[model samples]
Target chain A: MPLMTSLHSEASSMEFPALQAVSTEVERATVDRARAGDQQALADIYDWYMPRVYRYAVARVGNTHEAEDLTEEVFLKLLSAICDFKWRDVPFSSWVFRIAHNCIVTHYRRTAQRGGPTSEIPLDMIDGRHDIAYAIEEQITMEEVRVAAAQLPEAQREVIALRFAVGLSIAETAKALGKREGNVKALQHKAVAKLQKMLIPVDGK
Target chain B: MTEFEQRLSECLEALVQGRLSVDECLEMHPQHADALRPHLIAATAFARTADQQPSAEWATTARQRFLIASGKSLQEAMDIEPEPTFFASARVRFLLAAQKLRQERSTAKPRRVPLFGTPMRAVGALAASVALFVGFSGYTVQSADAALPGDWRYPIKLQTERVRLAVALSADQKRDVQFDIAEERLQEIEALAYKGKIIGPGVLNRFVEQTQPLVEQANDGNLDAGDAARLQQVSIRGTQVLDQVEPQVAAGAETELAQAKVISDTGVTVTRELVVKNPDRPNIVITPQIPVSTATPEPTEAIPTDEPGAETPTPEPTDVPATEDPEATPTEITPGEVPTDSVVMSELPIVEIDDIKLHTLTAGRLTLRAPGPSTGWYLDGVPESGVPLLVTMKTQNQQSFIVLNTQNGDMYWYVSAASNNRFDEIQMRLTRDGQVFQADAAVLRYFYGDAAEIPLLVMNSIRILPEASPTPEPTATLESEPTPPL
Candidate 1:
């Protein structure tokens, strides 16, 4: 019951507008300059993509510290490989997120080898802008969702993180994950269904 | 997909794009209202939580590091050579042409036969050769014009200049070509240095090698007035450019830079003497203006040892232990308020273990102080020299680790409250002798916001002891055990 009440309150307060991709012409010119080793142009690319990349990283790893480390690694790899990037049907955002995906996969692999905890959303990581009561409620709701999503299959988790958390379109998510569009849709549906079942009972007991 | 599933997907997309609210989505799909409501709420909450922006301090530091990496990557990419096949094919073509010409000349008799047998044929051959030359030569020369030392077209540029020199009928013309080539090398050095690329020794060596002869020629009074003026201009410009670029040159090229500077200075001296000898010559002005530099000044190599707004107080060594007095209290300082005047040690009771004190441990030039035995902190490993001295302490509720740079007195510490407390290994590996572990230091300041004062105070208490004479190793002698050992 508390979960339902908190969810209703959060729904009224938060907005879920779609995140727009940057203009193609400006991005293409910037990428061209970046490939030529222009520092300002490379900085521009980092400024535009760093946040979205961080969001996807945090959504996947569920830890701020790990997410920050992953973001740094992703950009370092980008610096080394940007010269070889060729424009194709895939957008630069897709290419960048692909790098993030690979980094997260590698991170998880290393953690598993060390037998460490896979995902943990710390309760103390709540933003301090809101009133105490509201912040606590929001933190609880957010933690529940993160915990539920982490229990989903890895592929399904990646689909929702890219599509919902990062605001990537289904097509872009497909390209980032190197999957078919139809497959991405299917995964998204199953993931949402599982999350709904876990967070809210279907029989309304 | 089932109809219900298809309807659910549509509602989710609509909600995400803000085209419909959750209630509106429920209204549109009345049958799937119960299923869609929770899903929409969960998706929104996930996005809200995941959309975390990095702290402003972290972002600023990360951006600086990223730019530095970009400079290094650009240097590396430019250093890579082109494919070997291109060079091999070019070499084969040159060799085959030379061999064919030699064979034709050796086998020819002294007959009066036209080379192409007819005027029309000769004209056609001439046109074909000209067409071939114009097709590739124009672009190659244009592209090679701006080629830097490590660039693939650099060889072509050098070869073209050599050909120009070979065709010059007069020594003055050849000398003029040499001056142009030397000036071009100077331009290349300035351009590469401005871009923050590593200027290899070969580049500076080439500049010195080419310009030294010109400087000697002018000094020996073997030049005309025009050539002397040109040499003066080139030498003056070289000195100005080299001085501007000295800071931007990457590490490990200092010897070559010094050699180049020496040649430029000699040229300037010789050229000035020539000018003094002939003051009546018109337009032989010695004061050439230095070009305005457009490069961003590189970051300085000095590491800031003192905190901002804090007085640089030299800590005095004390003979009394920190816990000797009952009223000795630990003072609380805030982050960036690192005490530099005196040793602020913890008042906890020091425990002596095995004739060695556990609270204070000395290694090389650094002396570290931990809280006490009750704090459940202990040294993790034997401290070593020539590397970062890692003192790791893990308690039940919190974990803290400090790395001391044995070379410098810089200290990097981290404290984490999470159960899985782990320091960044990559950052730890970046701790070299002379360089500051800037990223880790920034992280420490960010994470330890209010509570940074105590750890910093304890860390700042690490005194940089003076160097002492090495003690001679005691000789070891084998003692034979009794017959029981046999």
Candidate 2:
């Protein structure tokens, strides 16, 4: 039985690389160090996570320059805020993205108060992929939808953005927004009704 | 909501997702036309906006301007707004005045050139001399083949002058040579920046402009060395700008290395001082963690005492009881010790080794589990598999053992040399405080040699007495009764 077990171990060992286990150990140690408020560890996390955040911000903000500024500002805020963050129920990725979402919403709110319509979506910063032309075309329609959405009550716009742009589920959206799931659903329905009335031309011309 | 509104909302969702059928879009009635019209127009406006790519340059420029305008009043910043009208008003007066001046210039045109030409040519000659100096410097470094750190700056200077001269030069035979020289200098500057020796914003900006075409060309992926050199130039230029402004950008590395060296050198000195200063922080109240035993009974707590001369105050364990084992038992009682009280332990089972796999972990905690009658396990004297056990490791003589336990997974054995009765348990097992561990295979292999195999049932028995004597006995007989703590 021992010989059979040894043989089985040998076979399975050949299939799994020992280095994979080592990497996981290293990653866990690094994450733990980061959680302990090691500045270097936090910086490393920033270095790895920045490019993705920058790209996402650029896609949303529609200007490379603003996105770059926003990325730096977001990271700066994250550095100060993360120390006090008690990650109770959400995944770390979700927490980071929530920070990003808050930053974007705050920026829009600030800009809106300054009297410019917060509608110019920065499509130019997106990577020029093969289907970029099609993506742009679709993006224009989405922007229009967003504009029509802007005409809806603020409650509806929040629900739609949370649902579509952030890809949060109804329950997750509710949790994030601190609203009931039913309220979110009703707002979503009302928002959609208003959007259709705004979008579909009554004259059909 | 009306039926039309519901249908329209569904269609809009589909539309936003790029899944709307043409038929579905056409199905909207005239009453909903106001909303549908804008959507259609906005959707079709894509063709016009397709080529309008967003660039960061404008935003960066705006931000820089905003920074500069920081102290200015709102009215002062708005000063540029009314400038268009100001210019319009000035234009009327200037046009009438310029007509009179033109008539005067026509009369004085021939005489003015001699005055203008001498000074203008002198300035142009001075610029040409500076350009030649820059060109010569660049060529001298390039021919030597040893890279000059400041060579890129010379080409940038030469290129700037070349641009000026190219604009100033008349249609002459030397015009093409001027253009070629300008282009060559631009390329050379790009190459210098690409190599990372050259630094600065003015020089870097020149390199960025030179490499712009190559960057566009490299979008096709079959970029030649020249194109790669150009892209490298732009990236290096970006880094150079960053380096100049923010020297702390690479804060982790150089500072960390310096601090680490300091810490290593002052290791014992710093430690001794910290201990002398805030002695309270290091003072640990370590209750000798009770080992899990096979004879399941009504759980009792044990108040552990401090070992030897450790500075930590050993708080009396709350509500512990005397050992109830009938076999070997603890002989000495530290008199006057507070009697430990009993409290029903709450099952706040913390997930030990969460966000991680316990068995494979080397740096984080490793969870050990005992082979069970059912599958639930225990840690300490408690029955809770999910309790998050604090993971810690000890390294001695170049070998490292990661020791930790959540409820079900507990390591309770020792290495062969640590045991006193070696003959009783032939293969040394890991110990939790002092008990035979029947944790998983990974724990067994990690604690003992790879050849070690633990018995399924008897392995979970306590080994309270140190294994000093090699008592020759069958494992079944040795593990029949719980060994009391000596």
Candidate 3:
């Protein structure tokens, strides 16, 4: 039988080109040295997590400018605390993700306080399938998916962003969201189920 | 978990990966096909959305920021230097303001005496015009600082504030400025709410849209410990503002009131997290901002008992948990809002959930029914699988196994490497730490690769709870009697 890792996550086959796992021996060595004050290694760590953090934050915030600012703040925070960051078995990406998650909640809270609109995923943020070969029905279907996802609870929305937007593993997602792996599974199931109900077109055309 | 549920989850995952046709999954799992079909389709559509990647220029800029900050910290540590005034953030602003003052003074031209017979009349007239100009400029600029939706000059205010942000030297300064501006917007929202304007939600929407990013920036790591307390103050101000909002703008509208309530509630939570990270004050309760007080309160209002702008000496880094700000402290909970312990939102939300899920994870057991002479059997733990188990049968055969992870309806397996009779029963795993997948049941089916025709299915519902793994007694997972490998 094929290895379970390959079949279980399909991380290698996912369409998101940027979801490269940082499990290489080189990454571990860099993290170790960065903790020890190696400047170049620290830069590498920033480069590695920046795209992931930005995509995840941007997806939740729904504004590019806001996401960029938040992403910058997250990196700077990482800069200040990198030396103090302890490396347990958890991947450093998960730690960065936790920061992103906190930032999103805090962002939402602040907006709510100011009496603001809740974030709905912005259409401009999603790339439309440009290949003319794809049909109109597919575009309509994709739009429905976005609207459906926008209505989910905060926890469920997070699961969708991490899984579809940033493409983290179940274990990594659990670490990032601070949920149990089983809990992530349950959330993933619930969110998809809701999206399914919402996205399906009424019986016939 | 029903078999259909498991298959549906697996098929959904596959559909998300673009690996399986939705029709195929629906056709194969007819029991839940209709229910699963739409979900799979949606998942497929969503998965096809291209993932975002930051522009390379952004990547370079962010990289440089990290390098600059990291390098500065390293140099400071190596030199054993006191805190360096690393950036001229304040001095630069002061210098710019001074230069503006000098330019204004030098540009002032002497006005010719007007046709009035008396010098006093001419002077008074000139003074009135000058005063009018100054007042207009001052009022306009000051209003820009507190501009909110519905104000005639709100756009001007937003544009001027944008100019201020463009000049900000550090993320911390930007965050502070953003918080200040957001506080103004909150005041405007509350004021409009008090007036019972039908336009209240629109204004509130603008306030939230603008302030949320700022709040995120404030909470993000750029702030010093002192600034964390400042952020808490911002949230408290928001809570007070929401109290105003509920009675007026959201009055008689249950949905609007509920939204206002959540906004205020979240503000308190953010405050608690910051307080826990940076406990600057001693024996102080994080009192909510009274509504009237929030109308014009400063965003950086220190603890109520303390002087404004007073910096609590940042404690030594050693005394602070690496997770928290060295300057902010958890203030005591007020007399009635919430017990201090309940407000301890803690570092992780999942920690609270984990405490409850383990009750369902009964202790899993492994039993060997049939014994063979000179056969060594062992079970081990691997890190890769969240619920990983390495099972080995050291008989003269190459063996692999598959486990049906009933919790999510996925199946996976691994082949143990050949080993001599070194370990009779090594530590095995029912589940991984930080990985609370369902704990109750799994069926391990063993296959003799190149040794047997049909696979041997050992179906046992594993009732495993989380184990301490401390005592030297028999492994918590081993059954009392060995079940045969029939």
Among all candidates shown, the one with the greatest lDDT: 1
Stretches off by above 4 angstroms in model 3 are: A1-18, A118-143, A202-205, B11-35, B48-50, B55-60, B73-486
- Backbone clash pairs for candidate 1 read none
The CA lDDT at A49 in model 2 is 47
B93: Cα error in model 3, Å? 26
For candidate 2, state the interface root-mean-square deviation in angstroms to 1 decimal: 21.6
Model 1 agreement with the true structure over B53-104: per-residue lDDT tens digits: 6767778756655654454334323333325553333222222332332234
Residues B357-396, candidate 2: write the lDDT tens digits. 1111211112121222121222233223332443333223
Q: A205 in model 1: Cα distance from truth in Å?
A: 10
CAPRI category for model 3: incorrect
Error of 1 at B353 (Å): 49
Lowest summed lDDT window (length 10), candidate 1 chain A: A9-18
Q: What is candidate 3's lDDT per residue for B390-423, written digit by digit as tens?
A: 2222233434333333232222333332332121
Candidates in descending TM-score order: 1, 3, 2
Interface RMSD of each: 11.9, 21.6, 13.0
Residue B446 displacement in candidate 1 (angstroms):
50
* DockQ (0 to 1) for model 3: 0.12
Stretches > 4 Å off in candidate 2: A1-64, A89-94, A108-143, A202-205, B1-486
